[model samples]
Target: MNNASSSTPLGAARGIDPDLIAGIIIVLGAGALLTRTSDMPGMTALLPVTMLSALIVLGLLMIGRCLLRRRRRGDPEATAPAPLKVFDNARRFFGIVVAIAAYVAGVALLGFYTTTAVMIPVVAWCFGYRSLKGVLLADLIFTGGIAIIFVVLMGQELPTEFFLR
Candidate 1:
């Protein structure tokens, strides 16, 4: 009798491997940390370093949890359950990376407001926000609130497009 439970095939046709996903997360997080550490200490550098460290720690914790769960269950394979369908998680993470890249690129070219305006809505939609109105509303609230606090109230100088002069 085959007493072992079959491994859950989570959209294997999409060619997603859990180990690969973990590895990618580890690599990207490490790269971010390295890049940030090489730069002068500033708000920009500090933020990325902090975020990278958090991501690395979170990934490690998740991997450890999967290992522990597998051991506790006495599964012979000891493979962790895939929390997200491989392709979906891949797409989600990639989207986030792309958005971050876009933001960085846009800051100098398009200015803060324009970049953030597009990024906020795009990211929300990527995370399964189906309603266009809801996404737009969320973006407007977030962007507008930040503008009010930083630009109007705090008197901070935000980046502006050259053409606006």
Candidate 2:
């Protein structure tokens, strides 16, 4: 049924709101995270659980806003949902999957820091980032930040496998 012809039991028309759809999706994802993390031991689960809970709250707010907007607009009936452009090309999506798989393999052989540094530029290039200087700078900054987080802040004992081993 179209927007104008359909109406809820209370006579309010059912209109599809993008905000409400996105909010529902986010809430589902956050709920999944919450479910997975709730069973984990120690403080490892604490951060993710807290973050997911906040995400759920934000999603609900989005949904509430969408409902409010629809109510204020005074919809005539049910509206069709907007199309979500997720994958324009199947090959491109498959290629990205391959790239991620290669990234995982590369990490085992080349180490986390090296693989990440290389992967960032390749992924950026694949996504149409043509500026060499900008890509390099971004790659450097991103890799450096990750290195600092893993090596300095977390104190993870990760060594360069390809160079050292």
Candidate 3:
């Protein structure tokens, strides 16, 4: 049956809204995680639960916005969705995946801070961020901030450099 041509019981046209689909998926995934985290003892589950709840809220907002937009348009199926552009830059996408894989490996070999410091700027440049000063500043601030968060605030030890291990 061509549900796209049919009107929903709510009087909205039945058409695929990728954003709505994504939102539903996000909400479901977050809810699932929230349930799993509910088993964690004491305050250990606090952060994950809070974050997951926020994610669910954001996903619901996305769904609501999509529904409202569809209602305002009155006829959603009149125009087909634009073609997904993810594959249009297939090389860049795959390159990033590979780079991330390499970054993960590098973390074990070079330690988290060292690997992250190098990867951030390199990845930024590869993505066509041409400002050298900006990239350097961003890399420093990001790496340093994370280092401070994990090592200082959290009192967690960073992975030791391979040679230092």
Which candidate's TM-score is highest? 3
> 104-128 in candidate 2: lDDT tens per residue?
8998999878988899889889989
In model 1, residue pairs whose N, Cα or C atoms come closer than 3 Å (at least 3 residues apart or on different chains), thus clashing, are none
Query: Which is the leading candidate under lDDT?
Result: 3
Candidate 1 Cα lDDT to native:
0.67
Off by over 4 Å in 3: 1-15, 28-50, 75-110, 158-160
lDDT of 3 by residue, 1-165 (tens): 565435442333345676788799999999998999967765556667988999999999999998877775565456434333325677886997799899989999999888998998889888889999999999999998987876777666678877788
Give the per-residue Cα lDDT of candidate 2 at 151: 69
As for TM-score, the candidate ahead, 1 or 2, is 2
| lDDT score, candidate 2, position 17 | 56
Off by over 4 Å in 2: 1-78, 81-86
RMSD in Å for all candidates: 5.9, 5.7, 5.5
Instruction: Give the alpha-carbon lDDT of every model.
Output: 0.67, 0.76, 0.79
Per-candidate TM-scores read: 0.55, 0.56, 0.63
lDDT of 1 by residue, 36-128 (tens): 576654644554576677777777776676555545445544544444455656766787778889889998898888889888877777777
C-alpha lDDT of residue 54 in model 1? 77
Better of 2 and 3 by lDDT: 3
* 1 or 3, greater by lDDT: 3
